[model samples]
Target: MTDAARDLISKAMVDAGDPVEFAAYAPSNIALSKYWGKRDRSRNLPLNSSLSISLAEWGSHTEVAPSESGIDQVSLNGEVLDMGTAFASKALKFADLFRAGRAQPLKITTRNTIPTAAGLASSASGFAALTRALCGSFSLSLSEAEMSLIARLGSGSATRSIWHGFVRWDKGRAEDGSDSFATPLDVTWPDFRIAIIPVDVGPKSHSSRDGMNHTVDTSPLFAAWPDQAEADCDFIEAMVREQNFTALGQRAEANALAMHATMQAARPAITYLTQDSWAILERLWAARKNGLEAYATMDAGANVKLIFEAQSQDDVTTLFPEAQVIVPFAG
Candidate 1:
């Protein structure tokens, strides 16, 4: 860990001994203004601010407790994971931030309600819920914002997963990332909806982290991304605040395409969208021209997610029968 990260943990941890069982749940989120690249990888600080809407009831549930076996353990979806497994190893390493060289073993169990590693922001909810559970288990007195800061150490998108509804993560100016954290946006449109059109639900061929680093290092077009993304985020936020669905959807779709354009400009070119994905977008465009009100965004995977209001639910479903519609703010 970096000195900045260690110091943050040391300052926030009120107690790190005699841990008790603690559990937490965090909602998965889809970025409206995507967080593609990181400025500080160690701290998971972003190059530009981003906005997202949480997927209600679709997330992760994590539990942390003292290991009775006197060794660290991790499980996902009730299946015990070998310590050498990627998820298990990362979880234990994150726990080490609290242990701080101490020999306190922990048992971490996480169950994700959404598809893992398929571009649905599963890591975001996983880390956010783990952060909450670890803080509770270790007896940390940090507030939600403080928790968000700590969670960023695990995943940049995790910073926004700390809350439900609309959230924005500010890419702060601090070198140590002290000011970088996410806060819930005050606006709430109950009619807002998201529909997932899954293309490949399996683990992505390339992780978003690796894809981001590669794009940043090799994509010449990335030079223009930070500024353009910041502008897009600002505009999207304004449209969101005004509840202007048309403006918000247009900018969001444009921002997503712009992000993918950068990835395509990489040295070898990383294309996450498959031919089927483009077909969906083509169909969506045709429907939009015909007066269907919805917009689409994609991440580091082939799946496409659409944003629309409740009024367009029937039309969206009829157009994309396989789409899984989710009411983001439903009770």
Candidate 2:
């Protein structure tokens, strides 16, 4: 959890006499493209646009409950959090929406499905669940776009979780980040499953947050993220219109890794690319290297998720038998 929210949740606890508990969920996903470096840092808005699909099989779930008497309480997979402070931090971001005219406090509790130190995007799922649970508990019915804005205040990548299938995160032109919300794409999910294989490399070398920060502060390629992100967005629109699996597969694989390339050129020239990460990529490349059309994409961390037709499940399973494949059930 972000420290600013953690502190606020703690303060809310002292003032509120009561708090309740409820369950929330944060689903895992692979960025077919990527969501990186924020344009508006305070709001955690992105510098470039991105597209992704929510992975139904490999994600996180959280629980948030607030009492009728006072503030709320939170727990993730059974561990209680400083609900008041957490909620207060989140609540503050949207003071206009929740408070209406004055200041108020809230409590939030959450848990993550991804490994704590690994590069998998638990924050995206975590923030997504937080937004959903908080909106429900507060009796506030925010539209998907509105919810995405709230999620952005929590984390930039989180904005994508507002939808189930194909989604886009746009980098708006406003300082307030009103334009930086997620829009759903046309890829129907549950038909496609993701294989998330984390290469064990003594844990992630650097966190996505730190990596993105490095990209923004130092990398010369950072200048290209926004323009290229918009181009990727255009490619996505075409992907949906054509539904060409081959184009979709190839475009996504290259774009995702390209988004991460900035970190490689950062100040210290550090990279999270380990042997296992490349091993998976190598296998994917080998498949494409042969004639079997398969594509893969990754997030900020070290995991490689293979994207292929459900019909090819057996073949994928056979090729990467060691990887954890999540076959989505039709929803």
lDDT of 2 by residue, 32-91 (tens): 878778765666877778887776645666544544445434445566555355444453
TM-score of 2: 0.81
lDDT, candidate 1, 187-261, per-residue tens? 889999999987877667689999999999999999999999999999999999999999999999999999999
lDDT of 2: 0.67
TM-score of each: 0.97, 0.81
Clashes of 2: 18
Task: Give the distance in Å from residue 77's predicted Cα in candidate 1 to where it truly belongs.
Answer: 0.2
The residue ranges of model 1 lying beyond 4 angstroms of the native Cα positions read: 1-5, 115-121
Candidate 1: give the clashing pairs: none
Compute the lDDT for candidate 1: 0.90
The TM-score of candidate 1 is 0.97
lDDT, residue 117, model 1: 28
